[model samples]
Target chain A: MAYTIELFMVSVGVGLISGALINISIGYKFHNKGGLIGGLIVGLLMAIL
Target chain B: MIEVFGLNLLGLIGLILFFGVLIASLRGWIPQDILPVQSALMLTAFILIILAFILGKPIGLKDIQMNIYLHPITALIAGFLVAGALEAAGAFKAAINILEKLSKTTLGLPGTVVILVNIPTIFAMPCGRILAAALIPAAILFGYILAREHKQPALASIVVFGFIVNAAASCGPSPLGGIGMVGEGMAGGLGVAGVQLGSFVNAQQIAIMMITAVTMLSMSLVFKITPDELLIASEEKAEEKREKKEGVSREGYISFFFFFIGIAIVFITQPPIPIQTILIFFVVVIMLVAKISVKDLIGGVILHPIMAMISGFIIAGALVAIGSFDVMIQILNVLAQTPLGYIGVAVLIANIPTILPMPCGRIIAMALMPGILLFGLRMTEIGLPEIATPILLTAFIVNAAASCGPSPLGGIGGIGEGNLGTAIGSSGRPQQVGIMIGTGIAAVIISFFGFI
Candidate 1:
């Protein structure tokens, strides 16, 4: 498959979201909401950009 | 010549802070509890936001919300989860058992080590650590068996070294895993202005050939594992005992089938829909058939290296926003204009991860790839051969990805050290450095031959 710019951006977006959710879940599991917030902030930034 | 040190004031600040964060992350200078990926992302975001504020640029949640529309991240996550689900479903164990039996029929412990070490190349899972966690014990067991048979305890070390080389270097050929996908994603990013990223399969094939050859040869010549030792077999009764333990499970078979089905769908259809969604759909089906729990699915498959990748993306985005890549390209561009500058830069890029070892190749790739790609593009734009870009960039990608295995801090090398009861930096360093330099030199040579 051709590697298009559109595809690259989509991958970046998905990576950010999935990564945020995963970290947030881990943080919650451990009662480390600070980490959760940290993850959420990064995720939010990616979403915004 | 806009400002200080060839950077505008904002660019200078970004460059300083970016390297500062990178160095701190690499050196474990951050808070004890915070993950390196986490620190890198948050700090980068904070730096960029502050810089944007100073420059009077509006940054808001509305901008972040747009990240949800992107499709490729889902595909990347799906690839990881598919491997994760299969791993959770006991498919790897079954495969290991089958491999163990097959190894018995080959020469002996050396053959078993070969099979166990190289298994990841064929399986191509996203979770290299998890896969290593599972397989290292099996390797150790075989190593002990070899040591006992040969009456030399050092044989076990040889086996461990061999396993590290094969397993760590196997990341290149995996089309669906974090290593392969991240490399492809970086290549795709470089696909701007009519450059084709080429087939993921082709990259995988080249990675496999180069890594396997370099690693195996090093195992033999450097590690002193002779061909005769590899060809010898364990005692017949011991072989039978291993054979008797091999039994197929219906769940394992089904999980295996689904894993391949996911891969086949990816290869055959090349579906535009986020591949992760498709793979996860298959994973859900496997979970239903195999009776896997929702908790297990989320806990095991979703949380790990996937999160690491997210943090990496955020950090990468922040770097780009702050003009880090532009500065990097300017410096590298100057370097590229010199004699043999491309080779020098390729060597430096290949070794950076080893010097500042991270747990995942994706993190390093995400951080450095833009600069690397821009360097390649600039070289081509400057009248170098078109092949120069991919060959040089591929070399950088392969080395960066493969070097993570030998990282002294909690990567495959750490796992190997843990199993061998050796100190953290002592045992796996040679093999780690060997593979890093070996694969790197191999790529450079291949690229020189225009094979990349």
Candidate 2:
């Protein structure tokens, strides 16, 4: 349980840092575009599954 | 403790404002530095209570003690510590390095890198968007590195992997991720019956993942596009940053090792609040260890998450006010009593959420039991008032799946656009959006029959 807690936190932190970098580098337009595609695919998969 | 129709209304209102801002910003109408949903919601709730105190709306300044704000604050602190600590530990770096290394090998290079990196995440997390939030930077960095090497196909492959596998898998679960989260919620608290995630590792989840992966991988090869090489010469760049290495205590390695340990521990342990909390905890610790400030640490929580919450509020309000959720549920209830209505029931159930709105896409996963029941009952003509459970379950599936798709009304599309790259404003947007919709729709249909 402790281990899982640790991993989830780290993954989240890494995610945040990475997110910051993305914001600085490519700008939000690209980020939003990528997010939209990911969202659609994830949603579709979630629906039928 | 204050709740509104299964969600905290305080949070819901805040979430709506955030989502509205995100939509406005993405449309190029607003500035980028608006208050994040977390801050916005918390602030809104606080301000509202303050106003309420003046107006005597039940919550006074004294009515709100430190404990009142404790829940979200605890979540934030805990979330930050978990994320930072593990990132400082180094799991993230090693994993990225290993994946990159595998892609460099003669036999394994490029072709298998995405598949190798993506599988575990698909079954492990509840939200693909959340996974995307985690993986996109890694992919982009990989792409950046590859761009430096003039390895366009490699970079493309990495980016595609981030978008497809890590992002797409958040929708459905067999024994992994957020779908699993809602699956448990429905099976346990609601006590209605449907496919038990553990018992049902069907073809749906696998098939969608595979197809998307194949599509992205193939697109890379076909386009022969490498973002084609670096604009900056590699040698001159090396000299610029090499000097700064002495001052910092190398938090990256700590982040790399500890973070991997964190993920490994989570996979092995599978604790409460999901393993993601652990991942974020390590990230926070790494930042602290590395000397990043509380403000910077808070900044890492992402503005989009706040916006996503805001979007959730708008959606929940609109759905309830306009009777969208109810209307859809009624439609499903009508279809659940036929003999072979599973196909229609399945398709409809999967599609509605695409139309509805939400903060977290995983909310869609709760639909499995109801959708399945609707299909089964629709076929058998079970129209008793007691048959409502099956009816609700059907809607849940569609809502869950659609919420994650390319909906303009703030579904997973909103989350994706909020956090990842899309074809939003550029010429590529049409193609990107097309791919998103085409693939998503196909995946939805396939999942109906368990086509993994």
Candidate 3:
């Protein structure tokens, strides 16, 4: 259970970071803020699943 | 005869295409902005993959599948995220404030300048970009102050570009996702018994300090950059206002405290916790204390270095798949047989990254690490001293780490140039000379005191 929780936490952190990075790298480059929302959604979903 | 000069036709073509496109694009024989070097490298990898399929080489598949090294990539991402968190918390602003106060002490401005200029190497970060982005404003402010006080405008360029060179090279000694770790990891994998993973870090840091000093000296003596001539009034005013308004907040000191404490803990304890996990734990703590948002962290991430590293890995995978490294090794070995001998050839090979500098040192470091390793070991086999292996690796890694400083195409020096409003390649010559001397210093240090 402890290991599982640790994994989940790290996964969430990774998800958050990856989402932010993609948002800025691709979204900001193209002047689209929507990418942040979409990325966060996908990131959270990936983390949860 | 399917072979040309000891290499198969396929290997020869792969080698030619790999170096040809990379050098041509980087050197501006082909325009880089239109077809960026990373894009060109990815295309080269794709072409090699296609050729491997046509040639029916099964070995290529194994290499491609297994050799796309990801340890450094994962580490880099974690490190960058940590850097972003630290940036969002204004830890760097606090640092600049501390240095400013130090300048008023018995140390005075010149002593503070040396310390401030060497901060990146002093506290080596995973990506030099982290410190470079955070502290460049400080460099500029001090640089302008020095220039105005001395009535020599070139001092502005000197201090700024000197700090830029230091930031660029400091990554070699960084314990995080530093370029030096690439070599250390390679050495560990080679089962060179008793080789500690970070034995080269100290030597690299010592050499980098000399490199930064040499770079400043070179710029002062040889390069005549008139930043006063290039300064934009609006930008200058905005920068001055920004510097003046930033008072070190409580959160800034708090975040800075946690950041370094975390690194110190990790270094001393060698904890069982995953470094990523530990870093994340601190990030969360810092976020709460510093009142920074995810949005702020997002703004801190610069994708250029990350993307450049990945592109290099891809090309390395493709070349490995095509057996190009074997052909490269054979060529180096043959060259070692000449009047140049193993020592001469080894020195040349170690310094090649500086000779043909890329925009990101990791690109060359990753792509050519295997070939460098094999060639270094071969030199030892041919009666070069056993100690020469680590020395060669350290010299090569430092050279690769610092090469980006002089690179014309989107290298770290571009950041300093843009801020100074100078031409893109103006600092290239001085920076290169510094890197060359630094590489020599690294080799000498390792030869004298190295244990791993």
The TM-score leader among the candidates is: 3
Candidate 1 per-residue lDDT, tens place, B1-452, comes to: 23667765565566677667657765667642565555566667676777767776535544333322234355555665666667677776676676566555622334344445545554555556656766665666666666666675555555565556556655554544545455545656656333332233334333433343344344434544321223223332343466467555678777876775556556556666555566778878888878887666665554545665665666666666656678777777677568848667756766676566666666676666667777777778877677666665666656656666766556677776666666665544555545565455545444543332
Best by DockQ: 2
Give the runs in model 3 whose Cα sits over 4 Å from its true position.
A1-49, B58-62, B229-236
Of 2 and 3, which scores higher on lDDT?
3
* Model 3 chain B poorest ten-residue lDDT run: B228-237
Candidate that beats the other on DockQ, 2 or 3, i.e. the better one: 2
Provide per-model DockQ scores: 0.02, 0.04, 0.01
User: What ranking of all candidate models by TM-score puts the best one first?
Assistant: 3, 1, 2
Interface root-mean-square deviation (Å) of every model:
19.1, 14.3, 19.9
Sort by lDDT, top down from the best: 3, 1, 2
Model 2: TM-score, first chain: 0.48
Candidate 1's C-alpha runs over 4 A off are A1-49, B31-37, B55-72, B169-173, B182-201, B208-248, B257-274, B337-340, B441-452
lDDT by residue (tens digit), candidate 3, B1-452: 25886687777888899889877986688898788888888898888888777777644556665656666666677777778888888889889888778767754555456666667876677767779878988788777777667777787787788788888887787776788877888887886544565667766765676677677766766677777444634455776688678767888888887876777667656677666677678778888998888887677666777788788878888887777888988887788779988878878988888888788888888888877887778777878777777888889999998888888888889989998889988898888888888888888867865541
Q: Which of 1 and 3 is ahead in DockQ? A: 1
